[model samples]
Target: MTTTTRTIPFKADHVGSLLRPERLHKARKQFNRREIKAVDLRKVENEEIKRVVDRQIEIGLDVVTDGEFRRTWFHLDFMEHFNGIEGYVPKKGYQFADGVETERYDVRNTGKITFNSKHPFLKDFKELNEIVDGRAVAKQTIPSPNQFFNAGIQNEDIYPDIEDFAQDVIKAYQEAIQAFYDAGVRYLQLDDVYIAGLSAPDIPFNDGKYTREYLIDLALRVVNGSLENKPEDLYVTTHLCRGNYRSTWAFSGGYDIIAPTLLANEKVDGFFLEYDDERSGGFEPLKHIPKDGPKVVLGLVTSKSGELEDRDEVFRRVHEASAYVPLAQLCLSPQCGFASTHHGNELTEEEQWNKLKYVVELSKELWG
Candidate 1:
């Protein structure tokens, strides 16, 4: 079992967020309407966090998060909070597949980009660090450098050159990583969905000055850059996401297209990869992972649906992927978070818990 004594990259882990509960939804609405104060809202948030964290421990997870209960979008809330960046709704909504539309709000660098200690997540991490009973290690999740860059489109007036822009981003992430470490976060997960989306066949992104390939190359470089000089004890990993919205998906394709470059070059401790459906291609591309490279977490279980996958069948898939990477170097998780957004997947909360409980049980079956 992975514990404080064991390094992270644990046998069974889910992407950090769980579906938001009803009370949390109501509290936000209340706060938005000024029916409650921020302090009152935090009281509610803290209470729910206790309940959720206890459930995660009871579910037998070695790694736990605060369920991202305080935020709306996982990537946006964290990235937009960075110093020198400000948020606004874009001219058009982000059009995902199946015509799912979301208000296209984004960030732009209004001044020289920098890291601020008041970047709320560090405070959030400190609270979670205190909340966990120390039975299960609390892990913090942050948006990757690529996600930050993708969210904040390049402003020629602000950054004349892409490389010049990347330097600030790299420095900001380096600072953020250190801040989280200082706050007692030893296991951090960088959620980099855009990088995985870039690998898909369709290039659905807003890029007026940069090509898809150019953006992809820059994302790879910046992510690796942020990881430079990370503390040796902190286990920093990444979840390569395909869009997860209410059981819907945005990008389709395999890591094959980006594997040789992104996976081989990425210096993180491990990868949480999506392999829940045919949309994510075969495990053959996993062979490209260098022998000394980061380990892999086989995201074989689906967070998009409520139906729990069969245990034997799940193991069958793990064994199949092991043909490319050693089983010893692999772990299991959901393809993505049950709630990448506050609305979460189509499943009931009970179903979501069952899915996590299943991963814990399955990991024990395979790894113990």
Candidate 2:
């Protein structure tokens, strides 16, 4: 691959969510037990979010998020706010690696899904925007439209045809993208585990109704459709990981199976891909990424553990990936968020900050 001198933005990026602080976690539990009011809970969330945002800027990151402090699950908190979707507790939890199962909280499609004009997250973003005050790019992260297909319970009575369900999800996300842009958000990210799951050799919950290719095509359609007519200046991206709950992953595979379509055709500004361990497979599939396509943020450092990665090894891997895509098109980040859920990964908050500090330092040494 040829190299270019073009400068990539957010060279040291992250997959959005950060570990929830102990105070925030305690506040959430108190609120859950009716010991505190919703407003009181929000006050705690705001304080913690501000603290995290300040740390992100102080660490030399140009982009910052609310650290997903007000959320329980990184995706569900945002997804449940959509019209016709309601949060519920399921009997069974999601089984992660090493016998770790997620909590029973999940969302279900109760009726026709549509974007809620008064979506709570808009207010959430607005608060973060005010706190940021242009100090750094305020990024809003939500679950991908495709996530509805796999993560949510569809009401067959309300939507007998799966295609119809997909269309509603597409439209809802389209409105959501526009909504965030209107809410003073310049950078937005979609956290998608569904697409990554589809890359697996044998999909776990495949009912044999839809082929893998069909699902992949649908994912492209949903994601690209959501970006339709998005503001020219709005920076949108997607982060894909097999699964990240309490440091245990749900699937194992590479980008090879879906790269030709996902990496090449997704209408986004960048892609944050998981590549922290052998389970993510090789970088050969990155060759499918077009020269002029989205910038690839390689997640070479592991967020699941507190152990720091070998700096030289990370540098070498970046060069190896550049064999497929140009050096100028590549960026650096953790394999995934330090926390995809409020429970977080197997690391302390101090370790999380160190990991991000490592990324920022490494990017300067490599890209500067």
Candidate 3:
């Protein structure tokens, strides 16, 4: 594998949406009631994802995500694609301390060895490459290792021991990553908001069982354990979001808590950090980042709303962050995707494309 690094001064993010149409809602309702089979729903997802990828390239996006179009929620939807994984829908629903309620049923992994019948990621990437007219990077997003750990503990019937469960989860993830690499995808991003929430005093890792240092060690092990001996040219990264659902947030804390680990220890090519507001705190903590490795993508714009970001202000923050990491080692994008899940956030599809246009415009003016 070549260790060649390319810097074309392009800007992009981790993952994107699947552009679900209103018909999906009606179809999903049918699926929920047993009126339609899961196979048909998958077909809808494929068609929508194709449109999403085409639109992204037409808008001049440097990298395109399948738009997570087929997913109900990012993490669980992907986990459900695996065998032995089932959703545990609660009667009243588990409540976020932030007062937000999630309709998603918690996910659990069964120990039985069952792989995905067909890798959706492989099919989508292949389709995207065929249809897009120009050269654009292709990416696939999966939940972080910590996400799998959390999912395993969501229900008790699947696995009695969380540690053993984590082992199984890690094995499964390693397999999934390898499969994506084999399918010709070079960029893989692990979507993780769990670390950001852990920085808060309210909810801690493993239910507050570990301190910040311990949690960092655990996070490193989980991420790096699965990453061991992979293809060198395959670039893996992580995108951190406070939370984005219907324009509502789920956590509030600065990078101060996770700076040491997030900057120095976490293994990945770049970090997609949310710096859209004060919720992300100051940039001083970024100084802890090791100078020798990984690019840092400055997430200075907001995808929560359609309002365009002040380009000047975005540039200001970018330079401020550059105080630690060099500008050449940096890139820019929204704090998170417009629709982290299939709900598509509170903004319209037009707004999403406009926001991306701003990223491209700003990146060109600043970096060019």
How high is the CA lDDT of each candidate model? 0.86, 0.88, 0.71
Q: Model 3: which ten-residue window has the lowest total lDDT?
A: 1-10
- TM-score between candidate 3 and the true structure: 0.87
Estimate, for each residue in 46-85, the C-alpha lDDT of model 3 and write its tens digit. 6666777777777767777777666678777777667777
Give the distance in Å from residue 314's predicted Cα in candidate 3 to where it truly belongs. 0.8
Q: Candidate 2 regions off by >4 Å?
A: 1-9, 204-206
Best by TM-score: 2
lDDT for each residue of candidate 1 in 95-173, tens digit (9 for 90 to 100):
6679997656767778778898888888888888788857788989988888766644667688888799999999998
Q: Using lDDT as the measure, which candidate wins?
A: 2
Instruction: Give the distance in Å from residue 186's predicted Cα in candidate 2 to where it truly belongs.
Output: 1.0
lDDT at position 165, candidate 1: 90
lDDT of 2: 0.88
* Ranked candidates, highest TM-score first: 2, 1, 3
Worst 10 residues of 2 by lDDT: 1-10
Clash count, one per candidate: 0, 0, 4
Residue pairs in clash, model 2: none
Clashes of 3: 4
Q: Lowest summed lDDT over 10 consecutive residues: which window, candidate 1?
A: 1-10
Candidate 2 C-alpha RMSD relative to the actual structure: 3.3
